[model samples]
Target: MSQRLRLLSVLASSLLLSACVSSPKKPAPVEDRNPQPARTAAPASAPVPPAPTAPEPKPAPGAENAGKPGYYTVKPGDALIRIALDNGQSWRDVAKWNNLENPNRIEVGQVLRVVPPGVDAAAVAARPIASAPRAEARPLDAKPAAASASAASSAAVTAAKEPAVKDKDKDSAADDDTLAWGWPVANPVTAGFDEQRNKGLDFAGKPGDAVLAVADGRVVYAGSGLRGYGNLVIIKHNNTYLTAYAHNRAMLVEQDQVVRKGQRIAEMGSTESDTVKLHFEVRKLGKPVDPAKLLPAR
Candidate 1:
């Protein structure tokens, strides 16, 4: 029995050893290193800045005088007619604005009403009031003449002071002081001044025909601004007279140029007319007058 016990024990030990050997071995435990912090996303980018803005522009001085606010100070060369032409108004209209009895008179440094009087109260008030010329101081005691002759002479003078007599005298004066009459060209009159249609006289001529000034004058306007009167020249003979030569092929003089009577001022052409001709006009105080009355008889 004891032998049997020993053998059994040996067998049990053997089986135990075999089982332990057959079981799979487990890996050694890894060292517990600090766990990496969870990865965080980078911060978002900063916003971009806005662009800068530009500045506004200012207005210039001496701009167009469309709406006249202040008065126009008359400068050296400020004539009623010139002012009217520059301002696109008529001289008559300007005269009426100032209540001028005579349009011929204006003074330097004078403030003329460019805009209508109703436009601005300040401008109207700014106009310098003109005083009449001081009358010549007559002698308090004068030479006594014969009563009969003085009375008769006074009656005659009173009669001559009438409008009709004054007009006759003015006509005579104009005839006396006016330039010697001369024909501008030998061409016969093709058309005469017609108050209804023709503004002046037309003389048939060839291109490049010599055009003569009617009187001694200064060239006021030498341009093509007047429609239907292309390549024109305007001469101011005096304050009371002006002459125009239109449809000229070429102009020999310029503005403000002094010219003598019967001077060749232009070469005639049909700039705005149908045929080669010279268009001549005589203006007395801006009114169209018959050239035939002033020109030498043909």
Candidate 2:
């Protein structure tokens, strides 16, 4: 019995020792390894940048010279010869006036002096405006003796008043005083001058009818270079006036040739028009005037 008791005690002591060795220990308090994320809300997404702005556009070609005096802004497709023709100036004179080394090298948007250097915008504006001649109405029962006396007194008064007429009249006289204007064509009244539509007179005739010059002048332009004026002839009647004959079947005059009033310069045709016709234009300072007003009464 004693031996059995000693063996049981030794087994119980070994079991207790094994339990103490295998039991888990309390873990050391764990430290927080990572910090908390930022509390503030993420900044609002960057503002979307505005779209790039467009640049301003440029103005029309000749808009810069609108209403400007004596200065003509160059337009696209404008040739020096055509410019001179429209302005009633000699191309060489214009070239020299502008100091252009090359007449053919004119640039768009360039301002050109169409008149002489001494002649300014005021002079250009002072040019004459041609109008139809006015007739005075006589009293139906007036006596011839009374009329004669009235005429004599009226003449005396007119001489005193003549000096103070608008400067335009004097300017016109300066240009047309020596020119004895004659009718360009005998046939009349197919179409008349309209500032908006027709710039001059048009007469219907056969394809080879004679086209005459209305006044003495030098031919500055005689060719088909001007558009809408096929086979055109331009005459520089004087410093202030020019005449254009267009739609000709043939041009008889040449550039720099002087022509007299009633001289046949071209043969009428429908070069640019629909039917056979003569298109006559009278220009003062590059602006067209009514030929009927300037032409002598038929």
Candidate 3:
């Protein structure tokens, strides 16, 4: 019984020593292998885009006037006649240069050519135009042809009523005494009218000699704008007659003024002539006719 008591004490001591020793740690929980990604902040706002623009237009073809010379801008109160007078050109020629459909109709701000396209101003004015061939002079005291269409028409009617066998000399003498006719000046004629050499008659006179209108008419132009006719005066006797008195020292009448037959209209001088003379011309429809054809015999 003593031996059994010794063995039980030893076993009790061993168990106490084992209890005082360290206790077993619990197994660690299984850990996850992968981790979640971190969250990011959102942007405040989106950037603004740019605006679109419009495209440009193109020009049309052949819009410019080509091969033409310098032009003149028309002004108010301007007429083709006045412009032609100022520029030393004929109104008809000016119309031809500008391709004008209506000579009397031109608007302000319209462009016109002052000079001709190919011809020069001085050249055009100096060029002589030929007239019909006729005897230069008839009898010095012979009666002239009718000066105007109206006069000619009346003469025709009178001629028609007269018998074909009537004496021409007697009728001519009577007509010369009845028609309104007068001289342009008191001086002797230095040069007679010739179609080739002279376009009109030249009358020799002292400086400041009175130049008279041969018939009743209205002044159409009174200026020195024409190169060959210095201080010229143009008279419109009727729709079919126009008379020019050139190379005058002074003009006594203005354009559009009325004057009776034998009225003094200018003073004779050597403005563009060789001497102190009156250069007289008669134009029918712009073509020069012999003044002797319309002037009464001296």
Candidate 4:
């Protein structure tokens, strides 16, 4: 009984030592053969869209705006270059608008159309006139405040040097007695007067077209008495002027018939030439003057 007790005590001491020396550990959980995927940062936000823009409005037709196409009458002593420069146009544009073969050949009393910059006729006419700059000639003293006093004084001196304006009515009446001439017909001049050929100005027209008197005059002759002219009408305008319309289809006025300017005295016909044309002549004291020089510029 004593031997059995010694063995039991030894076993109990071994168990207590084992329990104190180490603890039982659980087995690790089964691991996945494939590794977990790495995480990625989110993409940057999309750029903001731009704002929408509005379209410009178009002008209406036939409105008179600041920049508009307009017409100007050519006065005496106006050349094409001068007209173009004055109207802010190019010589080429003037020539093209007038259908002029020669840019330098412009006559007085002709009307020229000027177009504004950067704008066409439709746009210009549609624009308002109040928006346009005033074209009147300004006084020299009304210059910018920043201008020097000497500059203003110079401008004043320049203004003082300009010639005084003359009354146009008085000038016209004074020039009236000088025997002004007019176009004999309402047609275009096809051929010009030539001194060497003795051919007078030729007007383009049909037979029986009325030929009018250039100025107030009394008919001196109305017959084909002169050679080379099939039918003729002659008028004595004044002491210095005697005008004739030859190659007429018929004479309307008799000898000594008083006719005013633009009065019809005969009809146009081709009596001398095959083509239908009026042979117009202007004589200064029995001498032939260039019909072109006597006729009013169109």
RMSD of each: 19.9, 17.4, 18.8, 21.6
Q: Rate the local accuracy (lDDT) of all candidates.
A: 0.60, 0.68, 0.61, 0.59
lDDT of residue 120 for candidate 2? 68
Residue lDDT tens for model 3, 1-298: 9899999999999998887686666789998798788888987888888786767744222124322333445556566654543343445556778887767677766666656576553443422223323222112122222124443454345335432232211111123234465788978988997767777889988876778888866676676644556667877665345578988876666655666678777777777667788988876544577877777787
On a 0 to 100 scale, what is the lDDT of residue 134 in model 2?
Answer: 20
- Tens digits of lDDT, candidate 4, 186-267: 8998888776565478889986676888987666556554445556777767534567787776666665566677766767
Instruction: Give me the runs in candidate 4 sitting further than 4 Å from their true place.
Output: 1-177
Top-scoring candidate (TM-score): 2
C-alpha lDDT of residue 50 in model 1: 82
Candidate 2 wrongly placed segments (more than 4 Å): 1-68, 77-82, 101-105, 126-174
When 1 and 2 are scored with TM-score, the better candidate is 2
| Residue 195 shift from truth in candidate 3, angstroms | 1.1
Candidate 1 has a TM-score of: 0.44
For candidate 4, the 10 contiguous residues with the lowest summed lDDT are 136-145
- Give the count of colliding residue pairs in each prediction: 0, 0, 0, 5
Runs off by more than 4 Å, candidate 3: 1-179
